[model samples]
Target chain A: MSNLIKLNGHTASVAEDEWLLVSLPASEAEERKQAGKVVLFKLTGENTVTNKQIANTVIPTTGKVIVPLSVFIARKAVLQARISKGEIGVWLSTHEVLEHLIKSQPDLNGLPMMAIHVERFADGRIFSLGTLLRTRYGYQNELRAFGDVLRDQLYFLKRSGFTSFQIRADRSAEDALASLNDFSVPYQGAVDEPQPVFQRYNRAV
Target chain B: MYKYDEIDQTIVDERVAQYRDQTRRFLAGELTEDEFRPLRLQNGLYIQRYAPMLRIAVPYGMLSSKQLHKLGDIASKYDKGYGHFSTRQNLQLNWPTVEDSPDILAELATVEMHAIQTSGNCIRNITTDQFAGVAPDEIIDPRAIAEILRQWSTFHPEFALLPRKFKIAVSGTKHDRAVVQAHDIGMEFYTDAQGKMAIRVWVGGGLGRTPILGSVIREHLEWQHALTYCEAIIRVYNLHGRRDNIYKARVKILVKALGIDEFKKQVEAEWAHLKGAPNTITETELTRVSQHFETMPYETLPRHDAGFDTTLVSNPAFAAWVKRCVHPHKMAGYRAVTLSLKPHGKAPGDASSKQMWAVADLAEQYSFAELRVSHEQNLILADVKLADLFALWEKARANGLATPNIGLLTDIICCPGGDFCSLANAKSIPIAEAIQMQFDNLDYLHDIGDIEINISGCMNGCGHHSVGHIGILGVDKDSSEWYQVSIGGKQGNDASLGTVIGPSFAAEEMPRVIQKLIDVYIAERMPEEHFIDTVRRLGIAPFKANVYTKEGAAA
Candidate 1:
């Protein structure tokens, strides 16, 4: 069945059956039926829930630990030693690191989810980030981006990840939906999902 | 001088218009300060310690008398009647108003000059040996290659967004007067075993927080692949160079993180993709560029002018100048005359507007309407006729450019440190003045012959302190000013960074330290040896011991 995709308030194809809508909050995850809340499950900066949070409370051992981009090998080793052995998720800021991660971990797709942050929509670093996910890392799961997201950037984001985005309240649902028709062809490639432009051209022969 | 053709003229004119629009937007408040900062800097406009400084490009340190006159006119009209010649071979007018910059650039463009990339984190003005075409020992005229690279890299789309500013220097002679070792990329043309010109490329060499001698990655790259190879290296560097930390953003850090061999392999991989692209150098383009610098028809005269000899013999001061300022030339009659700006107690490499006008007139009268700014903080008339030597010397003496102190103790290569540059840690001009005052005699300077006393306000090496024979570095010690002295360094082909003698000296103790070092050199020299040659033979131990001895300590 088709689902209602409310991205920054406008409705488009939810693609819930074909593409997953990965999010971060537990409450947001409960509200949506098909969408999954893959909260950054790792300790970062001064904030973020740690292993101690789950140690005192009763959480499932099947959960994954989502690590920050700046997390190092030493912290990873400590985190693995402290928590029970489970699937690990790594969130990165740039495509170069994503390439390194994919090269190091050949079976990264088997993990539940991997998310990347586009810190600011004004910054073009996300273009490289998206390019890496699709071209280099070949990540199949939801490539979520937060912070300063807008409707205009969503088109490129969709081509790269085929996932949903979180945008600011000032951007209306009408403008967000209008931007989806800005380009017909995929400017970039996505993993496990061939863009309509690419598929039509390739199968025409 | 290389005259601008239709394409060059169009680009410059379009750039001028673009800058005028940017300036208008900035003045009208459409662009905020944060947004306008990089825009202004990219146009060679700097909000300086006092006022906005306009830096104009002196492409490859080559300028015609007409260009110098135009620069003087710009300085006089828009600035405070002066321009400073920078170590990177550009000229900066320190007091130009923000409104006057577009007019200044328009004025410069009239003479086929533009300030593009003079201050931005882009490919800066390409520099080469001042004696590129005139040096007797030069194997090829590096100006041809310098101009080619300058044209290719100007406004290049792919490599423009580098992590940091990139500097490239070309040297035809093995002597390396261009200081190619201290640049981001250094290219030198050398004849291979087959007697064909091959380019030797050096990468990751820069003098800053970490001064590194670039490693030679490609020994005998064909001349046709110069641009493509350089573009490949920059492409790989731009895409991979670290940008998280500004300090760790240079290609040096990348080369350090990945070994030079690995960097070379990556560059080769990139070059393999770009080998036949539009960026590749074509023989037609090379010849077109080379035609601009082909040697002018020179009239050969006597090797030595009897008039110059008579004047030298008659006037002791003129004799001293002739002995120091004149250099041997490969041409039968031409001689390279060095106009030392390092007067007894003046700023190094600073020619006031008046001095600039004087040099322009002298170049027109004596030389072939050409002048060169050497990396050694001196101006050179590269093609002076032998017959005009005496007349030029007399006129130069009147304007104070004929300081007969070339290569002497007073010939100091200094940078405008804390006084001008915001990044400088210590004031360097006063230190240079102090040393110049202490050693004012031509006779004494002649005694302390051929010693390079380079001073920099900081470790950035703008003054080339690392390559000085007697290098002086200003350091802050316990909130007080101090200088660190180094010995046995050399700049040319035998380039080596100076080794520090010992602990740093107080600012007051520097002159005494220099005296003691010179004393050691005089006492230990093995007959007729130059300062660098003697230092190499006796090593820095004897000089270091003398300079830092407890008994030789300052009272």
Candidate 2:
């Protein structure tokens, strides 16, 4: 198993990942074998075609699978029975709004896992999205921030409310894990520490 | 003069260590140029025409004598023997090697100074009125709030990689000396109905290729919401600012595209969640930051120093210099002095190492050991006593700092254009020098008084030409250096952009073209009216007709 995974503030092997991502780039998926459960990202490329396919996709209930919200909403009846059994998880791209999923499935907040894709390391849309998922939507499960996850961005991602980071296949998890403590001190309120340094100064006094 | 506490000092020190490692990895080929570009830029290192230019942040333009001495030391040791003060109230060293920049930052850290966020897409140094505390028409001092912003924007996690660079300026008082509307997020401080400090927020105003004035979104936001409101704005900007085109990436374009109302709605929506969150300003921290800017050890002096007045009367040059360079201080018997950087032949704002050290010594001796770098690129001694003004003038003249033409046409605000900048389409320093030479007659310049001639290398607007009374923009025409002239721009409560006269002019004709414009102004201007006022009264039509003769700019 590949040892390029960082979960719960510790470096881990790929075997420890609960769900294998289905629609990762060929290079990333080929580098590691999937854990038995997989998050199917079938509608992944060429936006219009993928989106249309998602609209007409047949939800596969073969074993356990995490569904993209787009796929889940279009084919909710196919896996509606499985969600209560704690079998269905929801996945979202950082840019995808979660309000629709919450509207479609009231129990979406109680799902065991939610994964968000970061399109690029430099793109910070996921930071706000992850915060909203946790704070606004009350998502209290495995919050995964995957894709383009790298060393320099680890601390910010962790503070921005991602519980696990799937290191981009070519990067080392050991190096990325060390960056989580890049800043031990705080200045402003963030997802992980809501009390800015000013409040901390108050409590200290 | 907000001194860095232990926490502040530690963070800057750690940043120095972090940047040093990043630089090491880039040099070792572990990182590509693209990967290292943003990294170095966040630390204020830019690749310029000849070598690496490291921009050092002077937060709110406040500098102590010790800090100025350290800057002089760094300029001498790391680069050449000179440094350039930019229009943003920061210092730019134009010749440091990439390998030597880490050491320069490390040394800067010793003086509670760093180049962090000076040039990156992140929020830059927070600027305010250089005369914030000492100006005669002052409200509350903005140092505390500016310091708060300086800390909050430093090493911010989410906004670090925004689509374009962001600038924030706090206009401390009723007078818009900070040029509020020319910044990305400009704020003005005022007292509320409840006697609490409040701020007026202006989003999306900037001076790049597309110069646009800002609109007020929140006219009565309490000062406590400065952080939360700013956070909301940046968050909204971060998520939606267009990254497709580099030029359309500034918040100004975003605000323009969304329309000010819609943009304000989005920011307000985002702020609803962050409004009273833990990031809101508190009185405890305010008190802490305020103490650093508390009244200095000022001695009570007589209303007038008779000896100084006698000296001022006896020396006509001293009298003229006092009239121009000396500004009234809110503190009795004290004055604020501007040491002009726009002398006749020198590149405006370029100070040699010796000049830097001499100014630092003057700051130590005359101005409460504090100096300010104005956005106009001049150094300020903000707390000199009137009794000492004559002695200070003598020393300043000896050091080549007292030019006695503060508001005159010769006092030009110019960028290090084609001479030092790679992005410049044409040379701006030579244009400035030629104009200064042509207008070398101080008597004539004073007669035509209070003109702002701002020159920029290109549309990046580093020299803030868009708001100058007379704006000169360097443009490339058929691979040759040409200049475009504009008039009627002004920076005050009624700030407005300039209008281009006609066509572009060749380099050699710049001085003569400026001379012709001045001649028209002299012939037609109302008595004692400023150039901007005259331009506003007569409009650009007359100036255009007079400037573009058959053999002049039209040629």
Candidate 3:
């Protein structure tokens, strides 16, 4: 679990994150897909690893787990039983192909959690990706923005359909929480405020 | 002027508070310089070579008398007693402290002005023709739409951190006075086949290290789709514009790399989802905005005033001012007049607080209490009555605002280059001054007829050197300052980048080299042919040959 997560605009210590995200074993996943074999990824009660950097994966009999969307799609049969109970969540990186993911199988709509990765602080691709997922595709779940995220961007991150923020290490979660209300009014249309200023009030008057 | 309503007021007021806190954190050492740089830049505060330079937004060049007065107060109170009007329609205070910026922005908010999103990678101030509303040839008043664009771009969250700065210019008339062809996005208003107003959009135009004219992407887009379609374009660029190289980060590079056709395809695909969505412009909103730009109170006057005719015949200076400075208006009795910031021997666009106050008074007395900051680095009284021309001319002369060199060579557009900006390769202001001193003769300047001389400090083209008929670029030659001259660059509907003539010149030699170029045009030009027309008739070869002759080249 991460140190802190600002969930629903309330900053709290991350005592536990229901499911831990597991990165795909790239070469093995590709090889197993080529061989038409299912690869089961295990969620271990890890040590000596940051919550996001867990590496051990085989089958240690799973607890709740979140895998990359591709990993879950390849092993759908094994993951299907847990997904119905909202135990297996799917995660996607900002680097993933958006056009492919929007129309991906295993429907992101039913997931209990979908986390979008901000690989770099300046990479704004995830903002649009987050917007489309909530506004166009109508993804309604715990939408978390993690990895390389900071306090300065949390205000708009919340506006762009992000419900929870995993502020990057050692910085303030309370400060990030306060930054959410920096602007009491925003001019544009976003997930949080679907009605733009024009529709909300006769501004030009 | 578009006055701020409650929402507009709240946004700026909130912006002030937010910036105040950010400044406090920064000064307390909570925020590092790297982290605080972009935040400060977004508020139009740049840490220049000498001090913090704050650029105050003068939305599309329109300013009321009250706003002008407030700016004067701000200049004198927070900075040195002077400010410079930029090539883009904004004012730059060159001597403000980083600590005093918050108080400056707060003062601006009182006058319904703000510095939000004026700099940094976000969308910059939307510029149009300075004579937007009053131009006789205008098909539409671009201000209303420019205002809409301003609000849409201001504080836009997703776009606040773009790969590079983006600028947009709108032209409502056939003439491209706004220099639309040199911006990131240029829009022209026209009527479509359906008899509704539409926009002709140009993409990939910019003038930094690469000076490229915009290519037309969409020929006929309904005006209602402007904002949403713009969102689609910027969003695509935001996601796909190359971030690896700082030089290649502008939307122009992305548009060029993708090709206009491929880029248009992507933008159209994105716009399909956003078109007619919540961000679409509404008729009610447009109408409400348009009301703010409606015609000012004008009395019924004849096409020609007899008394004004007498004054013109007697006072040749006033007539010369009218010929070069006064512009035709849509209204019968009104004419738009240009107040030359380029007085004969002064720094091109520098105006003291005294001049600002004087202009504000003139704007109230003779021009309906409104003034416009022309992109050519001058002021405009857009609604001066014909009968008041003589009185206004006399007063403007007294205030150092009346120089009859509007379209002539002396009216140079220059950047605050090495003198102030951190990125400038060499000083630009001295080069402009040297040229101004050489051509100090008003008789020779007016005799030469309409020509534009634009100078840039570096390759940034902040002074729009690329589009000037005679462009001057300050370049560094082994830690020494040298200048490169180009010929035939033009702005307007037929905008073209100038071609560099030959080798660079020493600082003092710039004026003499320019003289050589002008001598060639004078010798070769046909009767009444302007410098640009002469250049087009003959190419850069003739001008290059004139400057690089044996003894001339040695000098």
Residue-wise C-alpha lDDT for candidate 3, range A147-185, written one tens digit per residue:
888777777787788877777886777566667778887
Better-scoring candidate (DockQ), 1 or 2: 2
Rank candidates, TM-score, best first: 2, 3, 1
Q: How do the residues B1-555 of candidate 3 rate in per-residue lDDT, one tens digit apiece?
A: 898998889999998998998899899987778778888998999999999999999989899999999999999999899999998889999999999999999999999999987888889999999888888889878899999899888877667678789999999897878878788899999777777889999988999789999999899888888888888899888877766566777989988888999999999998988999888888998899999998888888889999999989998888889899999998898899999999866788989999999999999999889999988899999998898998888899998999999998899999999999999999998888888889988889888889999999899889888888999998999998888899899999998989999889998888989898899988998999999999999999988987888773554
Model 2, runs deviating above 4 Å: A1-15, A24-51, A55-67, A85-89, A105-108, A202-205, B551-555
User: Which pairs clash in model 2?
Assistant: none
- Over A97-138, each residue of candidate 2 has an lDDT whose tens digit, in order, gives 666778887664667777787766676777777777776677
In model 1, what lDDT does residue B160 have?
38
Q: Model 1 segments beyond 4 Å from truth?
A: A1-205, B550-555
Which residue runs of candidate 3 sit more than 4 Å off their true CA positions? A1-3, A7-16, A23-61, A65-82, A90-93, B552-555
lDDT of 1 by residue, B315-370 (tens): 89878997899887778888889998888788888887788899999998888888
Candidate 2 per-residue C-alpha lDDT over B1-555 given as tens digits, one digit per residue, 9 for 90 to 100: 788767777888888877887788789986678778888998899898887789999999999999999999999998788999988899999999999988999899999999989987889999989898998888778889999898888777767678799999998777889999988999999888898888989889888799999889899899988998998999888877866566878999989988999999989998998889888989888888888898878889887999998998899999999999999888889999999998898899989888899999999998889999999999999999999998989998998999999989988999999988888998999999999999898888788888999999999999999999999999999999999999988887799999999899999999999988888888888777777888999999889988877663553
**C-alpha RMSD between model 3 and the true structure:** 5.8
Error of 1 at A115 (Å): 16
